[model samples]
Target chain A: MSGEASKAIEPKVLWGGGRSPFSISYGKIMMWIFLVSDALTFGGLLVGLGFARHAAVTKGFAWPSSEQVFTHFPFTHEHLPLLYVAFMTFILIISSVTMVLAVEAGHRMDKKKVAFWLALTVVGGAIFLGSQVWEWSTFIAGPDGDITTWADNATLKQNFFLPISTEGGHAILGMEGPQAYAMFFFFITGFHGFHVFTGVVFNFIILMNVLAGTYEKRGHYEMVEKVGLYWHFIDLVWVFVFTFYYLV
Target chain B: MERDDIIEYSLHSHHSAEEGVKLRKKIYFVTALLSVITIIEVLVGVFISRSANEGTGLWEAIKMGYIVLTLIKAGYIVLVFMHLGDERKYFKWMILVPYILFLLYLIFIALNEAIAVGEGMKL
Candidate 1:
């Protein structure tokens, strides 16, 4: 086919052959596709959380509010509701900003700026992960001590009491709590924390490459951009997680 | 294969100094916007008291507002931080539309199943 004839073909022909229809690199397109699937995975988890929460609340269970549960901040005995988690959210966001700055520097082929920003991104991710570990431990420990109890598993049916802290102390069945609340809290945030951990590793690897002048030798920094996409996706996921798990 | 021949690598050019300044400004603006929204959400979550059985409408309204604000934050992250906004229109929609539809379906199914479970328990 002549060039003129191919050019005259329908607009659908944009995806017909050798050229990239999306105007993005193959790596980038693949990254985005993976991100979309990842997002669905997270969405499923959140939706399940919503279902469990609704069922528990409708059954007259005074489901533990986030503000009530996440009241501990490091190095302080004061009752600070949701303060530490909010601080964690800011850490993730600042990491995201640094990541985008690295990508922008990549576009300009500014090796120094890119490395600086990428290092900051890694540090931010590490801090967030540490904060998550602290938060999870605090949650599991509860206000007084180990908050969950396991009961007899007779007839292959496991029974348990999931304690949520109230104004006075922990309570069991018919109290203000839902077992699934504690379960979902760990599951969803743990999942997002895993993402942050992965993103940190990825950013670290890319930062090393930048230090080694790999992209500089390659004449472009699309690798940085691809990893930046993943970093930002972590932050984006945290937005929803923070909103649903903490705020709502 | 050498990346020099790849269309994707060739697609971007170095930003001019002015463009760099503008991009930095936009990044700061988005960061500020995200921070403000987050602070507002935190304040609402902390300060607002929702008693066990009182002012149901206000609580619902606050919940809806929270969702909207969260969505706005998500949009800015994807569009600006992820640079999805710079991509082609079809590419943008291809990435966005599916998530929106899936989220709507998820919400519907979650509510439906939860209601069914609740009624079954009542019985």
Candidate 2:
């Protein structure tokens, strides 16, 4: 062995730093980078939401409880607090699980299993997207009530206690409200819903590729794995969105 | 290479029946765990409302709990579904540290600005 180490010359070989130093493939790492950037964007949205909400509360505006805002389920005349959102969240999470299974099957080179699981994942994502649309409609339509205006531009449009409400609860929110919470809610959640829709489309495309045996030709399921990364990120973001926008 | 092809049939089985069954079980376990946590989160919202309805303090406490629980779910998804749990420590930190720092900075800045705005509005 040489007594002294060789001079640290410029890398001329594989370690020239063009390749991933990490154990993972470059594509997966790229996805991680994208996700990190996406996470920051979401962080900004949520922080902005926090600022607006805090200002609303400090200004003595009534911010409606999440339970009140998300109580409705399609075709259900009952007041089920957070029922619809809980269902939406569950459906999204289930889709994530299916995505995980699809990726796993890809790793196993099980084309039939991969296609089956990816199809299910696509369905789950579509259902969640559809649910988001329904929830958005319900939100925009708002509770059945009359607008009672106050000084400045604050308004509280509240419907009588919804039947599914555990206690007599009035659903209160509007543009003129002290906080205008509805605006922030619509913007942030709509942005997230758009993401979910895109994810659904992405999953559908990946599913088609799986069924076509594209990865089978390559003898690797890395494409399925890559798309799984994306689907999982969508699920992750929704957790934060759910917390900040609804439960919090 | 007999032919140039876009896709070809797989000639190998990558997983055995037993392994497939085990993986299916794991998938079911994760789904059940996630669903149960969601249900608990919902039930907490519904049942705890009685006390939370009594006071703002109680309501805030419940919200804090909600945040903690959501973070748990988020972490679990990353660890299991994203398979980050099994990654090297350095890799985990590389991915997680930036997000943690960003969220903390956001919370600090937003809350501070909110307080400042509140004071400014107190004309």
Candidate 3:
């Protein structure tokens, strides 16, 4: 009956499936669809985080200020809030730029330039991952090495969740009141970090392909463009993660 | 490869040297723009105090500023870096509309949930 109805109506050829109306390849279109879905998943996690933070704030529970908790900079004794994260953000942005360059090089069939830029992108991704691991370790260790487990609630409460009023602001030094902050921090950034890890791996594989002249034989570098889209999506996700997780 | 596959593969030809240079320059400009915005965001986050009183008007404004700036950065990444801007309009909308609508819905739900939680705590 549905087929008869469609035959009677005979809509435009756009949905006839003989050709793509989008003028792009099927693979790229599929990539975009996958990315949109991934965006929703990440959005859900971030919104949940915001909800938790708001609830904590409403309950008069001191939320762990990003300034206080993320203050430690490597090899520096002084408190520096958001500096290391800014550095990592820059690294990711630069890597994104390199990825675009690689795609452009591929467009021109410049195999050498494509390999060069892809290698740089891989390095940048590796560095960002290293920074995230260091950050996770520092957070888990706590400032005074006191926040280990829930069993050590007595000392943990005193040392880790202290809400001391500092000269800068109302600083909640460690995990703060409910300890949900640390949990959210771990889960969200850990998820994004895992993406970066995969991105690095994918980029390395593509670079190897480029070096082996695989795309050269195929007469196109569409694989690089595809991976470049994924890489940029990773960077795009980081922009939101940085804003929600650290800045706001 | 199939005849259609051969025809569909990379319809655009290689860029000339000057065109490549121009493209690289645009990429650098975008990189610089993103970096500058990120630095501003960091400065605002670190220097601006969110006093003991949560949900002050000023703090809310700053939060909004962060979101707007992040959106701008995200736009550049998607449109320029991902080459979404170069695609046809229908494809662009098909890819972007769902994402925009979903994110806006999530943000709405988040705000409402927070408000409700706050009100509950008051009671």
- For TM-score, the strongest prediction is 1
TM-score (chain B) for candidate 3 is 0.83
Q: What would the per-residue lDDT of candidate 1 be over residues A70-173, giving only the tens digit for each residue? A: 77798887888889999999999999999988888877788999999999999999999999998877655535222232222232121334443344664534
What are the per-residue Cα lDDT tens digits for candidate 3 across B1-123? 367533353544356667788888989999999999998999888888554434798888898899899999999999889978877667789888888888888889887889787778642
Error at B56, model 1, angstroms: 1.8
Off by over 4 Å in 1: A1-16, A142-177, B1-6, B10-13, B51-55
Docking class of 3: acceptable
Candidate 1: clashing pairs of residues: none
Better of 1 and 3 by TM-score: 1
- The complex in candidate 2 yields a DockQ of 0.33
- Error (Å) of candidate 3 at residue A128 is 0.4
Residue A83 miss distance in model 3 (angstroms): 0.7
Q: Write the per-residue lDDT of candidate 3 for residues A1-248, one digit (tens) a residue.
A: 00111122233654566656555666777888898888888989999888887776766676666766677678776778788999999999999999999988887789999999999999999999999988877756645222232324443433445453465775534343447776778788889999899999999999999999999998878888888989999999999999988888
Q: Please, what is the whole-model Cα lDDT of each candidate in the order they appear?
A: 0.79, 0.71, 0.79
Q: Candidate 2 vs. truth: CA RMSD?
A: 8.5
Q: Give fnat, all candidates.
A: 0.55, 0.50, 0.63
Candidate 1's fnat? 0.55
Candidate 1 interface RMS: 6.0
The full ranking of all candidates by DockQ, starting with the best, is 1, 3, 2
